[model samples]
Target: MCGRNATAVYRFGRPGRVELTSAALTMAMRGFAGGGETQITAVNKDYRYTVFDRTSRTGFGEGGRHDTAMSSGLLIQRAGRTVAAKACSRDATVSAKAQAIIKPGPYVPH
Candidate 1:
């Protein structure tokens, strides 16, 4: 697989170093508020994953050993829903573990 990240159709889970648009984020929140569930799949060749969301249910891995990470195992509040993902890579792929949420400050980047 190439060292650079690849972009493909947005799928739940297996969330790679992918970014979500604010509009999409809003929709996700709305779904949660409306008692709807959303799913996302991540595809990076190295590791792919699938994620499911629900209003009544907590973010990914709410059962045990909660790891708040943004990539696949990320858990953060967006729009209004608490999102979490599970991460996994190919045996040949290596990945860095990171926190899902980065507290925002007063300053916004341009």
Candidate 2:
């Protein structure tokens, strides 16, 4: 996993066998939040995410023009509902890191 300040590769295994380090996760969170204040709870999580590819071209030649693209990562939820994100969406790698954290499992606030 690549964090804001560090990178690591985790190999999952049997329960209690593989553990996610706090430092690595923190780095990733920092990258996602971009040094912005983040709030984590059983309800939701918030952060600042800037899109790398914010501009996109639409249509064709003459009329073709560049426009801002609007996109966001998948919605994460603990139960049967969707948890609202404060500021979500960034580059592909950052989105992947965010997804990894919200994957099915226990939530440990960093």
Candidate 3:
């Protein structure tokens, strides 16, 4: 159950705290773009999380909510599909989560 905040592997995405278990991987994204944590379970590998344009203490609860105008559920670039990861000489089951909000800003794409 021991965990600490650290930079993401190869800086592939936002930095966060990592907590590992025999059956799952937990990461709580921190800093300006951080809102909640993403948990990747071994059984499904589905990352249940909430992150967005603005910080909110209310996290993604029970996977029974919808994306608001300001926030969206987690986005994942699963392992074996990330090209930047291979170029960086890192090979592992890496998962990335990006906040998908519809707004014109650095977080959103044109």
Candidate 4:
């Protein structure tokens, strides 16, 4: 009936649409840093990311804080662009999860 092309959303090898854009990362950072209304400070000239250690947090919704695991990732931005990122996990998983949604800019390292 309808045609759906997942390829448009995916790029085999080296990712073409996954990494976060500079603006997206900046907005997120600003929101988290200044309550979504305050001006954000410049930490660096190049895009930098702070990786978070993901391992699941306790339980949720009446499950009681017994034991649960969760994975997490931190967003980093540079002068409006996200360049590099680091996480407690491997690049493969990160690359897969993001699924080429944003697409790294040209001249970016593979």
Tens-place lDDT per residue, model 1, 1-110, is: 11223222333334574343221111112233324333333333333333333334334564663433222122333443434333434212112211112111221111
- Stretches off by above 4 angstroms in model 3 are 1-23, 33-70, 80-110
TM-score for each model:
0.20, 0.25, 0.22, 0.24
lDDT string for model 4 (16-95, tens) is: 75433223321111122211111111133465443332333354556453454544444456666665554436421223
TM-score of 3: 0.22
Candidate with better TM-score, 1 vs 2: 2
Off by over 4 Å in 1: 1-34, 57-110
Measured on C-alpha atoms, candidate 1 has an lDDT of 0.29
The alpha-carbon lDDT assigned to residue 52 of candidate 1 equals 35
* TM-score of structure candidate 1: 0.20
Q: Model 2 over residues 1-110: C-alpha lDDT tens digits? A: 23342343332235688532222222212222112212222222342221121223333454654333433333234444444433344543334444445333233332
lDDT value for model 3: 0.28
